[model samples]
Target: MIVSLIVIVVIGIWLMSMYNGLITLRNNVANALRQIDVQLKRRHDLIPNLVSAVKGEMKFEQETLEKVVQARAAAMSVKPGNMKDLAAKEGELTAALGRLMMLKESYPSLKANEEVNKLMEELTHTENQIGFSRQFYNDICTKFNTKQQVFPTNIFASMLGFKPEELWELPADSPERENVKVDLSF
Candidate 1:
């Protein structure tokens, strides 16, 4: 009887450990998402200043600027949803920013302007930071998802409503347009 009781207690302790592990994984995923949010906000804060600085020099690219503005608004207004939808919206915003940067290349004056140049440099740095944050978030999601889909943890995860997260992937053509091929080979 004492042996049976001890075995039961051991099983109970194991289950609790599994449950706590799942909880920590979930929290890590949430924290990673929060990091992405902070990076995105930094990007958003830089946009208007960029747009205003380039507005005059990029007069001919008004449509591109408008698209960036609209896309930013759309991204900002995205409703709470599953990770898949959120990831898709993030891709859309990335595409919009890509277009804005492409448009920037057309204005020689804008490129040379000291203030605009500084803001552009900052924006570029912020974009890189956001990309890093996104990778970090995705890595956390992978960890959470792996545990949630595994054997004993899967059972606990299902019971606790833990679900897989979508990877933050770039939209098709996002990278293609963002980095234009400059044929430097002579």
Candidate 2:
């Protein structure tokens, strides 16, 4: 009877350890995702400033400016925790912003505007940060998902209700996936 009690206690301890590990992994994934959101917030905030700064210079580029605004609106509307929708919206915004930025080369006034230059620099930096955060988020998500699928933990993970996270991948046909066609015929 004593042996049975000891075995039960050991199993209980092991189960608790597994549960804690899963929680830690889950939290790490959440933290990484939040980092992406932080960077994205910076980008979203800068878009209007950049758009306004260049609006007067890119007089013929109203379509591009409109696209950026619409994309930003769509991106900002996505609820947190919906990574799939968020990624898609963010990807669209990125493409629109990229197209807008490239037009700076076409418009000499935009290139000369100090405000536009500063905002563009800040937006570039924020994009780099967002890229790093996304990579980290994906890495953490992979570890969390792998942990729940391996060894003895596998048997208990689903029983404990853990789910795999969605990774931020650009859709195969996304404009961001295409090679940027730069025109230098100014």
Candidate 3:
């Protein structure tokens, strides 16, 4: 009876440890996603100002400007937890912004304008933040998923109803995945 009591105590401690670790990992995954969301929000907010700064100089490229605007709207409308849809919308926005950025290379005045240059720099910085946040989010997701899939932990994880976190990824065919072609020739 004493040996059985010790076995029960040991199993209880192990179960508690697993539960706490899984909870911490799950929360980390969520926090990582929230960081990505914050970066995306910054990007969305910056788009209109950037577009306004360049609108006059790129008068002929209304379609490109409009595409950026529409993409931003679509990205903002998606539910925050829907990673796949949000990623696709953001990809469209990124591609549109990329085209807008390349146009600056063609227009000497836009490149020369201080306001446009500053806004462009801010947008570029925000893009870098977004990229970094996405990588962090994916890393957390890998940890959470691995925790729920490895060894004896897997057995208890499912029993506890902990589900795997999804990693954010752009589809292979996404235009954002394509290398940007910039022409420097006047």
Best-fitting candidate, scored by lDDT:
3
Worst window of 10 by summed lDDT in candidate 1: 172-181
Reference-based TM-score, model 3: 0.93
- The CA lDDT of each predicted structure is 0.78, 0.89, 0.90
Off by over 4 Å in 1: 170-186
lDDT by residue for model 1 (2-113), tens = 9999999999998888788888888888888888888878878888888898888777788888988877786777776554555666666777777777667767887789
**For model 2, how many clashes?**
0
Off by over 4 Å in 3: 182-186
Q: What RMSD does each model have against the real structure?
A: 2.9, 2.2, 1.6
Writing each residue's lDDT as its tens digit, candidate 3 over 98-161 gives 8888778889988888888899899999999999999999998998999899999988898999
Q: Candidate 2 — which residues are off by over 4 angstroms?
A: 1-9, 183-186
The digit string of per-residue lDDT tens for model 2 on 118-182 reads 89899889988999999999999999999998999999999999998888898777777879986
Question: lDDT (0-100) at residue 164 of candidate 3?
Answer: 93
TM-score list, all predictions = 0.83, 0.88, 0.93
lDDT of 1 at 41: 81
Clashing pairs in 1: none
Clashing pairs in 2: none
